[model samples]
Target chain A: MYQTNQYEGMIAETVSMRGHNGDVINAYVARPLGAGPFPGMVVIHHAPGWDEWYRECARRFAHHGYVSISPNLYFRDGHGTPEDVGAKVRAAGGAPDARVLGDLDGANAWLRSLPYVSRKVGIFGTCSGGRQAFLAGCRLKGLDAVIECWGGRVVQSKEELTPNQPVAPIDYTKDLSCPIIGIFGNEDKSPTPEQVNAHEAELKKHGKQYEFHRYEGAGHGFFYYDRPAYRQEQAVDGWKKVLAFTEKTLR
Target chain B: MCTMIAHQVRIQGRGKSGPEWFEVHEANVSYDHPYDLPLEHALNIDFVNETLGPGARVAVELSVDAARQLVKTIEAVLAQADQRGVLEDRPVAAEPARSPSVA
Candidate 1:
């Protein structure tokens, strides 16, 4: 794994593509500079908006030899500071699930269309992004794998369901088209341990290829080194598993 | 975990977002992650004029205790103003003041 000199480089930039209803949307693309085709990864930003952290996340995937695509799901709302747009979107009761799915589908297509792509793609998401990742894995046809890290609201109670999210994501388990590995914190409130168990049961019932890793003494957003919830040991191990899963499944 | 819990109400207020002050037409409140706070989550408040754009916002993140205390304090001040007959619920000018740079 160690080489003193390996030809290494990457290109990261912003690009526009068609999203829902053929509307053009912005997305960040990061890819290694070599000529051979590379595996693809779609990085869906959390509810915090498509901020700097997610952009860096795309680059991190590129560094690991995956072509990463991160779309600004809130682009239709407005553009400003990430926090401002995030707050506005939250106030409006989160980005419409339909819209996010459409944007993600578009991003996946754009990534597959790239000349340097391997045609296999994995999706990575945290918080609400995680929920969308799982939803996409079920609703979209081409995703090869899913890394759903601490996604909440997948098992919504009838009361928790909103007009925008009329059905629970778990209800779509039968449609999951790819193997999925989940990263969850035991202490997470939204998807409590029980909800995680329920999600597992659904997968088991459907006989879907899936795995879940639960971390003790950690809560939501454990990989966000920028936040207080970051757990060094857990995040390190989790990253190893995520990269391994992507490699084994997509590469 | 993103609760996706938030509510916005129309309000008349002036808020200083960054260096300049602007007229705020809405107050959005929620319990969610904060942009500047160190904790996992907070009771967030946003004073904004959405028509002016996303930047027309002054945001605050407070702990649960702090948010409750703020609500009680606001009630107390309003009660005192009401008892003293000094409350000015209506604006002196029918038209609200506007900020040129903020707009």
Candidate 2:
């Protein structure tokens, strides 16, 4: 059981564990104000780390009756500011696939061990977080559902920030054990229509339960209302779709 | 100086022998930004009619630079389409995967 923070109504706690490469991992857990175990959701942050936006996202999930955990994927080096972490990520040529998959597994185990979390858990993310969600559904086990929004598909040999590689979701569609949904902007250059179409074809071939939403005239980051790329109508509609998907699958 | 302008172009007309109707739409134009400008400024009634439809609505928001670039791109595409006689003015059907209930 975890205790609430000084803010009140927000269940906040911390845990220290080991990640994929045996690096020490630190994570934050947030739950609803009420009692009883709730549905678990592993919320992966974008590449930089656990910023305020990421924490608020976890709180939002908690508000909706889920035990949300946001893990620090870059905890190996240290808990630095977002800018510092961004620099490190750039210096390291971005995160490697092996390390990311391992950290996701570690986060999953941590969520499962939480006393207030139910056995059925899901994963959700956006941008880099979305990529992690896809990896979790593909490489991890026992996930009930997964939601990925605007995740970049890097096509390169060494995991450089934006190398050309097969779309992540498409490449791993056959290995997914749970239903996965992806949202993209038609104008997002990172994952072009060709890439999205390939992913859809792969899902169709495997007969997997999946969904892909492409908003015409909307560019990357359309769901982020705070950003210049935000499209309010599209973002609202996307949120409705996400909530409905969660309620149908997570419930 | 850089300026951002938002515009709406409603095209109402009959499609060959079809019924007459008006399509309400909005476009955001930005200057100096290369990518979004072209897409935004290229957004005239015909472009909207071709991309959206004679009866459909569209909303576009972009920076000033992007608006100019958008107009240029749209004009280029339109010019080419005109020469080829493949300027499709019909509304495009929304892809199935974009639907919320798609399973």
Candidate 3:
């Protein structure tokens, strides 16, 4: 049993699992206090790993009756704190897709093995986390739904300043076994309107169930409450949409 | 010679809902170099309006220079105390040219 913290009706717990080559991965799990099985959600962290805000998000989902687990993706590289991991990630250029995908697989396996978790599982992420969520939907088996918030780089260029290898989610639309909902700020520069449209077209071509919401006047990181770019109204509304989608797809 | 005092006001509200009313009270503070000027009131109003927008209903008040200085000092102290993290933080991606909105 994991030590639990109660917030509003949700129970938060810290857990650890083994990942690629037996690397220990740390995660925060939040869920309603109940005995029977419940729907589970895998919450992937943005570039900065396992920050307090992400933990609060897991608690919010748990309060809504879903089991949410947030995995610290950069733990394998000995990046413990957000600031430390952020610095190291910067020094290394950008996150390699191979490491990120392996982390997601380890997280998924952990969630599936939990006795309290139901067979229905979903994945959600913001920013870099959002990209991982899309990858999980297409690459991972048994995911019922995915929600991506402002996931940048649906198309990639090697010469770009960001140095992204560009694993376009559009290319994997045909492989998705479940619905994917993407939320973005119209003012965001990273995932510009053109990229969003390209992704939508790919989904349409594959006949995949998907929804895209764009908030006017909001910018990147609008959903982050601690940041100046936060748009409280838009973020709340987006959360509503995310919950509705998850319930519809997972239930 | 004139010394301009800078103040920041944050207006918070919920979705599509109108702005909630808030109040502020003036505090006594010493003005260095320049004693007082009429533009102070107008400048304060402009600052509040620009940051919070026109629809927001806000109460006006003066804060001491010491208060502002204290905040700066506290921020500096916090920054110095902050332990650096291992990961390097990157700035948000630069904005791209506007294209057609998705249907």
Best by lDDT: 1
Q: Residues A1-251, candidate 3, lDDT per residue (tens digit)? A: 12367434567988897765567878899988886488888887776456788899888888777888887776755533464344234334446666676777777788789888888888999876787688778887888999999876654443342433345655777898899999999887667778778878888998999999999989776788776668899999999999999989887
TM-scores, each model vs. reference: 0.96, 0.64, 0.66
TM-score of chain A of each: 0.98, 0.86, 0.91
Query: iRMS of every model, one decimal?
Result: 1.6, 18.9, 20.5
Ranking by lDDT: 1, 3, 2
What is the number of residue pairs that collide in model 2?
Answer: 24
**DockQ (Cα-based) for each candidate:** 0.71, 0.01, 0.02
Candidate 3 lDDT over residue span B1-103, tens digit each:
0111223334322112123332212111222111122221212221112222222212222345544666699877667666544333444343322211110
The true-versus-predicted C-alpha distance at residue A45 of model 1, in Å, is: 0.4
Q: Chain B, TM-score, each prediction?
A: 0.86, 0.36, 0.24
Indicate the worst ten consecutive residues by lDDT in candidate 3 chain A: A156-165
Q: After superposition, how far is residue A129 of candidate 3 from its true place, in Å?
A: 0.9
